[model samples]
Target: MSNDQLAAVFNAGIREFDRLTPQVWGPAGQSLITQLRLRPGDAVLDVCSGAGASALPAAAAVGPTGLVHAVDVADDLLEMGRLVASDRALHNVDFVRADATEWEPPSTVPAAGYDALACSYGIFFLPDTDQSVNRLVRLLRPGGRIGVTVWRRGALTDFARAYADVLARHLTGPAPSRTDASPLSRFDTAAALTDWLTGFGAHSVEVTELSNLLPATPQLAWDLILGGAMRAPLLGLDDDTVESIRRDFLSLLTERDVETLDATTLVGTAVVTG
Candidate 1:
């Protein structure tokens, strides 16, 4: 997808983070923080920080003395992050409205300067993953760490697959290849992910497959998408097509029941090297 197209998806999808925050974020945030081993007074940058999910936890870990820069291309999402920081009286966090793929660090974040950097479930959206990864790496101090997460496989992500399949069936034209349309969707294989991460000059790179429950039914899951992330693409669909997809998806997931969908993400962490 083009930048504008992806940006629109991001614009529409930001709210989904908030709606599913309690179930989806708790483990993600905890795992990322644990991996980074965030210390008191550490200056951390969370790229594509949707709704401050990672920022809030980082702020708590770094305490009042440290800093957390939450960056995203979506202004609305940044505003949400600002509100979250305000509500918590978190003086250490700052929100920046910018694209991670082309972000220039401010003077406060010097060349190779941050104590650590994070892009939780965010890197996959960038049109140029390598370039974005390099930019994020630049923000980190030498020996500092970087943490990233991406969806592992579509088969393992029943909700996402169902949503995508439904949408794919309706498009009269050829469906966009994952690489052409959504690079995030392309790295579904462990081998592909491993090669991608290692190619980015990540050293001591550790890869782990993490899974979690959605804590909601298939219908509720669809409702979350309807109410949040998928609003834009979904709005473009005709009512008949939309209903068909919904019915098909429901029938497919009836067996999963009202439990957390067995969603898996491949998490990779590595230290920046000169």
Candidate 2:
């Protein structure tokens, strides 16, 4: 999908995204912050800072003295993040609407560059992943750290397969492709993630696994897909077709006896040696 198309889909699903934030993206964000070892007064750049999942935590972690610049392509998501920050009275975070793959920080951001950069579950959408990584590295000061998170190989595979099976049976056109071809799949493993970071000139690359298991009902599974990454695929389909797919998808889940959702994430961190 084009950038504009992706943004529109995300904007439409912002409400659902917000509901799932605490369960899916929230812990992943915290894990990224912890791995980056952000300290008080540290400046952080949260790329793809959707709904403040990571940015809000970074703001609290940095305290009143520090600043966090959160950027995303979806204006609605950024606005939601702003409200979240306001509710928390976190004046330190600035949510900006911009493309993570191509945006440059405004002059108001720290001239010395950021101390840490965190991007959780957002890198795969970039059209040029390597170039984006290089740009992020350049935005960091020497010795500054970068942390990224991606879904692991087995993470949600069963759920996804179930959904696809149902979708294929309902749709008359070609079945939607699996997510395995996504750019994020490149870093689904620790070794690949470490290698990618090192190739980007990041030193001391480390990859860790975070296991998140949540109680799953068929409805919850459907909601997750509708509100999250799967939103793009459902676009342009008729309501009847979408509902049919949803029904079959839920039935498959029940038949498979899937009890919980395992959204295991792989977090990779490294420091710029420049």
Candidate 3:
């Protein structure tokens, strides 16, 4: 699906998405920022920053002297981010609604460019993952930090297959998995992610696995469907059809004994060579 489509889906399910923040998005975002080790005065860019998950934490790390531009296509999500920033009195972070692939530095950014860049669980959404990220990395100053979070190999396999099986009954299309042609397939593992980052204008690559295993509860299962990219499949379905799908999906999870949602993520960070 396109980024615009994704924005629509996410915009329609903002509540569900935020509900998963504590168990799903929050940890990975924190880990990514920690790995990057943003300084107090660093200028940062966080793309696909849903509700400012990583961006908020990055703002804290960068403090008042630094600035963080959280860019995403979803306006509602960005509004949620703005609210969170206001609540926290975090004036350094600005959540802007824009296509991250074409995001440019603002006038306030130093001419040398951003001191660090981060994208938590977002690279897969880019049409040309490598090219888009390569461009973002080039926006950074020499030796600046670049970090990304991605699903580790086998992460959410059971949940995805179950969701796809349910979808197959309602829709017509091959289930998208980590096939050779898929962008995610290129760097789901630590070794592959290391090499992928190195291929770009980055070095000193570090890949850390953030093992996040949450209980496979009915609420989380449905929230995952509505909140994240998986929601794309249910775009045109009516409420009744969605309810049916949800019922079947949860039942299938129970039948398959998928007790844990493997949210295992790989947080990869590197120093951009510029």
Candidate 4:
């Protein structure tokens, strides 16, 4: 899907997207922050930061002396981030509506560039993953750190497979997969991710494994499907069709004895020594 389609899908599923934060996005964001080991007075640029999940924590980590710029393509999501920042009284973070693939630091950013950069579960969406990331890395100063969170290989296999089976029955086109051949497979493994980073001249690459699993409650099962890019396929489908797909997907989960939703992730980090 194009960038606009991705943004539109997220905007359409605003509530579900944010609702998944506590269980899915939030933990990964916190882990990214911790793995980055942000310091007080450090400046951070969090790309694809929906509702300030990682950006909020990054602002607090940097404290009063530093700043955080959270950028995303969805205006509604950015509004959500701004609201959260306001309620939390985080004066240092600004959630901007922009494309991370083409992000550029404004004058307010330090001349030396950001002290750290982060993105949680949002990199594969870019048109050219490695090239886009290389551009973002240029926004960081020498020795600065960059961190991103991605799905570990085979993560969410059962959940996604069930969804695909149902989707395939409802639609004629190909469905998204949770296993091999997916776009995410490019760097799903630690070795692949490390090599990708090193290919761009990043050093000291470290990949942390975050094992995530939750009970397959009815509510969560549907929300995971509605809350992300997965919903892109269901966009133009009629209400009854979408509902049928949902119900069938859930039933398949039960029939398969799928008790857990695995969201295991990889938090990869590297130092940019220019």
Residue pairs in clash, model 1: 1-181, 13-229, 213-260, 214-260, 214-261, 215-260
lDDT against true structure, model 2: 0.85
Put down candidate 2 lDDT per residue, 27-65, tens digits, no spaces: 999888888889999999999888888899999999999
- The order of the candidates by lDDT, greatest first, is 3, 4, 2, 1
Report lDDT per candidate.
0.71, 0.85, 0.91, 0.90
- Model 4 residue 35 CA deviation (Å) reads 0.8
Find the candidate with the highest lDDT and give its number: 3
State the displacement of the C-alpha of residue 125, model 4, in Å, after optimal TM-score superposition: 0.8
Error of 4 at 90 (Å): 0.1
Q: Which RMSD does model 3 reach against the true structure? A: 1.2
Worst 10 residues of 2 by lDDT: 171-180
Query: Counting only residues 3 or more apart in sequence or on different chains, how many pairs clash (N, Cα, C under 3 Å) in candidate 4?
Result: 0
Ranking of candidates on TM-score, top first: 3, 4, 2, 1
lDDT of 4 by residue, 149-253 (tens): 999987888888889999899899787655454558888899988887787678999999999998999988889989888898999889999999998999999
Instruction: Estimate TM-scores for all models.
Output: 0.82, 0.94, 0.97, 0.97
- Provide the lowest-lDDT 10-residue window in model 3: 173-182
Report model 4's TM-score to 2 decimal places. Answer: 0.97
Task: Point out where model 1 deviates above 4 Å.
Answer: 13-15, 110-112, 154-157, 175-195, 227-232, 238-244, 255-260
Candidate 4: what lDDT? 0.90
For residue 24, model 3's alpha carbon misses the true position, in angstroms, by 0.7
Off by over 4 Å in 2: 177-179
